[model samples]
Target: MFIQFLKENRYVSMLLTLLRFYLGWQWLTAGWGKISSGKFDASGFMYGAVKNMSGEHPAVQPWWGNFLKEVALPYVDFFNVIVPWGEFLVGLGLILGIFTSFSILMGLTMNFAYMFSGTTSTNPLMVLLGMFILVAGINAGKIGLDRWTIPFLRRLLFKKTEKEQFPQSA
Candidate 1:
């Protein structure tokens, strides 16, 4: 029932758009800080993530921690480039409502990854908002560019040519 309301109502969509803006701002600032830095690095964060494995109630699963240390740490330099730009792009996508669900999904994925690394800052709140927006589906972006963009893309990419082949009857 609530989901239906969110899908159909304008007020709910407006509220979700506000949430999207807030979340987008958070992502944009975080990424912009890293990108603007002369030499942004993820080695420290990766090291800390690996270190989380030692605690009794480790934030990361042992297997996942091992993967991070063995696989991720080795490529910290690459992550250093990817993470910042990815965050900025995700923020831009969400703020513009271009593929909003995809943006929310990516944001939620990052939020979960942060939680798994034991950094419990605003990640949980962001996750909740991302989930809410995801559940809202197409309506979530109705107030943003998706208003026209989605429909246009759908018509172009998923256009039903067969349906249009039928001529009008007299």
Candidate 2:
């Protein structure tokens, strides 16, 4: 099946590596830009999203807008810190393939948040590419650090306990 091919195919993994690099670069640069600027703020953006809930066809739904106004706006300081750092970390993870699936999921989450806020930009395209990387799963990161980290983590987490390993005469 197509899903199997995406998950298991070496060629698909190779292609995914390329896409991962592209997405990673985009995120790193965007985050770096904000971080370096030292003036990144989400309050204005949140306010705009809330305002966008009006008009003939609202770009942002009232429910999301209300959440933004009530929850997000009140927590603008937190958003200001996390947005840039989260983007940077996601980008780094994607580029290094250290935690490819988690990185892609985080990136997708940010993309969806941006879209929900009515800032389309390249978020949709990034989401599409990210979904492919997600479907490809471990294979997508096989060529990178996940090659060793995943197996190591798996063994560490799943290793048998002392009782299980040394169960004897009872």
Candidate 3:
């Protein structure tokens, strides 16, 4: 069944590979641009934006936004410092087809977060992108290092099912 699925849906794989690669590359490039801007500072930008909006009308009040001001502000500030680097890493991982699923998962997490905190126009697009990443399952493991390592790691880290142990022996 799995082999048939792959053989029949190979075009789907190609489409997803293209989509994931371009999106990932775009994200990484954006992060690189931010880092190279010299004036770019995550903490300063996020905190300044938050401080500027503390009592003003916010587009949305994602639960964490309030916590951001109350308890997470400092961490938010700290995150700002690292976010560009994180974006770059995630993007690089996805584009290189290494840890493809993991990278998409991370990207989806960020997109979902954005979807909740912004105006409807931007939010829906991000939400759609996240859904695409999830549904496409574009791991591309066979074409990359993840193929060589992740299966072994999974076996070491997780319990094998009876089916996995027995396979045709069942």
Q: How would you encode candidate 2's per-residue C-alpha lDDT over 1-170 as one tens digit per residue?
A: 99899899998888989999999999999999999999999999999999999999999999999999999999899999999999999999999988999999999999999999999999999999999999889999988899999999999999999899999887
In candidate 3, residue 23 scores what lDDT? Answer: 67
Task: Report the C-alpha lDDT of model 3 over 50-169, residue by residue, as the tens digit.
Answer: 454335666546355555556555666566656677778878886776777777777777666544444244435544654555554534434455666777777788977888888985
How many collisions per candidate?
Answer: 0, 0, 0
Query: Candidate 1's residue-wise lDDT over 4-62, tens digit each?
Result: 99788899999999999999999988989989994888788878888888877888778
What value of lDDT does candidate 1 attain over all alpha carbons? 0.88
lDDT-based ranking, best first? 2, 1, 3
Alpha-carbon lDDT, every model: 0.88, 0.94, 0.61
All-Cα superposition RMSD per candidate = 2.9, 1.2, 5.6
Comparing 1 and 2 by TM-score, which wins? 2
Cα lDDT of model 3 overall? Answer: 0.61
1 against 3, candidate with superior TM-score:
1
Give the per-residue Cα lDDT of candidate 3 at 39: 55
Per-residue lDDT for 9 in model 2?
90
Better of 1 and 3 by lDDT: 1
Collision pairs in model 2 = none
Best by TM-score: 2
So what's the TM-score on candidate 1? 0.91
